[model samples]
Target: MSKRIDPDNRRRYFIVGSVILEIVTPVFRQRLEKDYKSKGVGCLQDFINSKPVIHILFHLRHTNIKCCVDSTNCRNRRKLPLNYSQWDLLYTENPGPPKHHCHCLYTTNNVKLDDLDVTLASLILLNCCNLTPNEEISIKELREFKNNYLSHNIKGAITEKEYQTLWNDLMTYVLQLDPSKQDDFIRIQNRPLDDSLCNKYFVCLLDIHKKLEEISDKLESSTAEILTAINGQSNMELLTKLEEILQYVRCQSPKEKTDNHGIKQQTPIQPYKLGQPIVTLHHQINLTSVVNTSWKVTDISMMDDGRLVMCLPVQSRLLICNTDGSQVESIHVQGYPWYAAAVNNSTVAVTLWGIKCIEMYDINNKLKLKFISLPGIMRLDSGITAINNKIVVGGENRLHIIDYQTGKVIQTITTKCNPGRLHGSGDRILYCDNINSNKMYWYSYTNARHHNLTLPSPPWDMTILQNGSLYVVCKDGSVQHVSSDGKQYKPVKTLQTTPGCDGIHYNLTQRKLMTIQNKNRLVTVYNEI
Candidate 1:
């Protein structure tokens, strides 16, 4: 026999689980209806009633379909190019005599809004529906809350304080989707949860867990197939294929500063090729309108996932946004944020102006991880970058490389000029002087060699492409491109802004260039022609 659960703890679980099933699930269904209607369909119910299995499969190609077919002989089955394993929960599974049946089987089962739960509703909203950035964020948060807080509580217990915190967070997400649901949440929270009601909620929670486990099993099978394919390669092809596999595996897991050997892994540099001289504006956003403030953007950096992190010095905050300029979240720091860098996919390190400290944040969780103070009281720290397992910071005419894990200074290098903004690739670090010098410098850690290249104007900030080339923004409203060797330079694009550009970042995967006009409070994105 299983141990009995505490009544209070069971009540806590019941409240959270009930809110998701009763309040959140209906909102997701409504949104799905709205989305389908907007896409030329009359309504979700009508669409399911009229459309055939082929049409449904096409519409839901974005979902996971691994379980729909036999894995041992998957190739023999008539499978669509994408996943749709969650189809049975939403539709009837009648193994048709004509496998590609055109009859509308979904409506025959009379699947209603009540049949949909939080997990299935969330997956449909995220994968099938076209959502605005805010809607996307809300749905993702609700899904995470279910997984982390509700379903994973093996003890079925939650402290009073934790219950309140979780309740508030869930309420915030629910309100974002439908403000009218506020009263529904409050009623569920205060309602008396008896054994019968709690057991019902417990069953719902178990259903969600089962669905999640199915998805996880499918992913594990897919990963195993990939490894098997890699093993079947010839010796000559194995080396190249192994490197590509490693890169893919790294992308799947949480990004780390160092590998298992405690050695820094250099990002593989792609071959350099000059792009066409033509520059086309892809998107632009006014920072003032988004934040409702005229505060200037101090610096900007791009995460591995393509989100933009911008420093707002006057507000002492970091404004995070999607690549299309939709606001994601805002983070407040302890001091004035001068420069920001993506430490990894989920973490960002920011340098504080007039302070000798660097703060690291987990942007995904919206929590501050820790603070690292320099050894001495060297204020005015400006430039910052993360390479491998270390952080490089610029302060007072010198640079300090610190281990990110221990916050210990590993090495310090003296410089002739105070570095303003830093960017690193492989063993080299590129920076511009803070004294308004018309020169850019590149330092190599391997040989301890420093090389300087004179530019047409004072350099403000810089970003490096995957091919090892550099794009430096200058004070004269001109953007300069330098060869990997730091020997050749030319103007790539010149903006006619009054104060020139203050920050620049290159997205190697997307092949887009993002620049910040701090004085104008504008952000412009450009595509390579």
Candidate 2:
């Protein structure tokens, strides 16, 4: 018989959904299990990881049914595209036993047990390296990692040497996670360090040693010609050549000075870091565009031909502008326009806030057809974007990931609360979580991982860099640049701005920053800090 849905499935789903929804919240996550147990589901987390979800309903008529469908869909499948390292962990399968798998976070069935450890370890390792105590370790699970390993059999998969290296790295970060270290991290961010912090903590010994080991044995042999020249030629010419080679080595390895402002940073900012390079502006030039309208610009979209389309919320109008922020055309949108996104060179998609659906426009800014108009979200304050032939709309307590080609929801990722701003880049989605108490939720759609190990401050607008680093402007008037690596980070080098910062975008190819500020209604522009 096909595995029938458990009779207790409804109750179990209700318990799991209710418990997870409640427990993971700001206040509940802070509570101990002993406290949650008092709420009648002491072992709810344990059940969450063990629950077998065979069937999931996409839509349910009742609230109780909603629990079952939503809970089952929130899992990572092996078929999903994971990062290279995560893929490597999967390849190195440890098929010891299913019992060894995580019993509280995820259900183990298809993925090997060893992969689970590796996956969890890798995830923790990423966070351990990138996020400070202020960001990750205030929680109980991370702090408990030092003592508990489910049933306490915490052994390394790699050899002793590799294990020691990983442990040392983890320990160094664990110490940094101490509340004592957060002030230091924040302090160093405000000023430059006297010595090279990168030389010590920043250097992942494993990575460096691996790189060095790969070349070390071959080095002596590759220099055979030089060695022979040195040994046989006792002439002054040989000495001169030797001296030239030494000088070349010295030139190749120049000293690194973070104290200086005119160089590049090799280790880009980590995601959890709150500070980023910024500059201030006082000049307000009307972005000269030809499509003159009394309506204010509510949304901005960039076309493949390097033009911008501005959505006028009041008049249901779109003003197309050139690369220099000059106007190209003014097209009228049917009904009221809320947000829009660049789909391709020939098409752009718009979300009708006043109306109940999405509309697509031709490159000339002419309406092609109405796409998707889910009534549930149209009535709410919502935002939409067309990414990778897919339309992502946020409202109704969920993000509807709809495919434009088929007009279907490919996937629906529950964010658990209201998302203020929704933006997407290269299959990556970022939403400012009104629920994270303001933190931005960045999902690398391919890998199913948060771009950074942690969110910076609760964010307002976010722009993705060429290298996948996130340049975000938080409500606090601070701009933060977080690297994709999700590791150790220091704040900000200001390209040239002061407080009252508001809007920000990374001009990846041009290497510039296009920023708009509310504190000073000026369009401040600068080479990225």
Candidate 3:
């Protein structure tokens, strides 16, 4: 008998909008929208809930995309109530309008571990690079924790035992830190330990401790008593309570030194371009392995103390090992997290799908604070980046701007379409069409103009050089250079990504571009051309 080969992989992506609306087959709409209890434009949860199937809404420069994939199992849709949502990141352009305006991960699809044993809390101490001395020791002793769990090799799945042990060790570790140090360690262990976390990490860490304790006490009490306590606490506002702590934290720059202006000095630009290198994108699903590890060297990050942090993406969890990639120290994160970005050396942010929110954590993986619900959008493989104190977050058709100081949404600028690789520097945002005609455009958030320039073939991602030059990752696994304003985007003499291309980041100080080319498993570090 012959074995069945997978030949039905669909990779074609199309764009539809107010202008080039696709020929929506009436039969298709009739069959799919029979249960359409509500309808309109813009992402509507109410309308989507009424239907079943994987529905993705894409809003483009001058169009709108409503692509619905039939539920793998129509029955599962009814039984599980698993609904997908999209927002306004790729909707239509916004006029600066009674005018051009615009609009709107994880989990259920990830491995479902039965116990917390799959948690690898031991990675904290495994950081051989000395990124986190305290964490390295914790990971080493993780096996000693009575509740430690073990993770398996299956893709997208974690071993439940490892998860439990990891959390137990985390709980124990937080209990042992001195108030100040404990606070920092707690948040880091709980979230991704990236160096670019916004300034809110430390402040949020303290808030989480307070809130979690309150919730724990409430849970241990009777329902009525808990409700009463909750009501009383409601009298006090969360934002107001955090004001004083927020004031003490400063916006730590990503640079190596501080300037007279009180900000960290950004690295100077070097003259060169992203050289030609064949990069690939790994998007294989149902990958079978006893323990598929992704520590194959392309990951890059610095510690809160300013040391290099070597990281690997294993399924939903990130294993932060030392520079040598030996002695697994501390593996932070509990579930299948989607993406992460460092606020600073000491803090990072993670998105938890089950909860539909993004949280900030300290180096020890302790929850510092939970902010902004994803507003519930669908579409996996999105992006988030923090520059200075402002943040550029990818939604469906909008680039959500977050102000960490006040912990609020400062502004949500409209975009052209579903953004692929998102990078922001100074005051500009550069993004690609993810999977369209393969185009890239720049948004001068400061001026609110689309720059009227475009790149060839949709781009994969982009980053800015020290001289403020733009570098774009193309669909073919290559990098190109563009004018700062995106007016002149010409292929960077030579650069390429093959097999499949994913994400990218640029380190100004080191003059390096870190990226995950083929599988997002191997991180590649490249010097200027």
Q: Against the true structure, whose lDDT is highest?
A: 1
Model 2, range 1-529, lDDT digits (tens) per residue?
0023232332222222221121122122223233334545434333122233111111111122322334554444434323434334323334544443321222323332222322233232232223334545433343343223211211101233433443333434434334233322222222221111111111111122223333333333434444443444465643443343333222222222231322222222222334543434322436423323343555565553334566666766776654444334667876677677776654777776666577778644255654675664535447676655577877666677787866767677766455556777555677765334545666655555554334455666667665456676666666666665534333455632575455555443233445654334334444333
C-alpha positional error of residue 482 in candidate 1 after TM-score superposition, expressed in Å: 0.4
Best candidate, TM-score:
1
What TM value does model 3 have? 0.44
Candidate 2 C-alpha RMSD relative to the actual structure: 24.6
Which ten contiguous residues of candidate 2 have the minimum total lDDT? Answer: 53-62
Residue 485 displacement (Å), model 3: 3.6
Q: Write the per-residue lDDT of candidate 1 for residues 1-529, one digit (tens) a residue.
A: 0136567777788778777766777789899888777877764555555433334443444333332323232222254433444465455655655544332323334465556677767866775667989899999999888878766555555678888777777888889989877756655566554333344355346433343334332333454454454333455433433333333333222222444434443443344444325346877877676666557888888775456798987887888876667645788887898888888655898888898888999765567998998744246757888876588888677788888779888888887677877987667788877567898987876567788999889888888765567888888887887887788877774444566787888764445678888767788987644
RMSD of 1: 20.6
In order, the Cα lDDT scores of the candidates are 0.67, 0.45, 0.41
Native-to-model Cα distance after best TM-score fit, residue 426 in candidate 2, in Å = 3.7
Ranking by lDDT: 1, 2, 3
Off by over 4 Å in 1: 1-280, 375-378, 494-499
Q: How accurate is candidate 2 locally (lDDT)?
A: 0.45
Better of 1 and 3 by lDDT: 1
Task: Encode model 3's per-residue lDDT on 287-367: one tens digit a residue.
Answer: 123225443322345343222333333444544432223223444555545555667644666544344456565544444
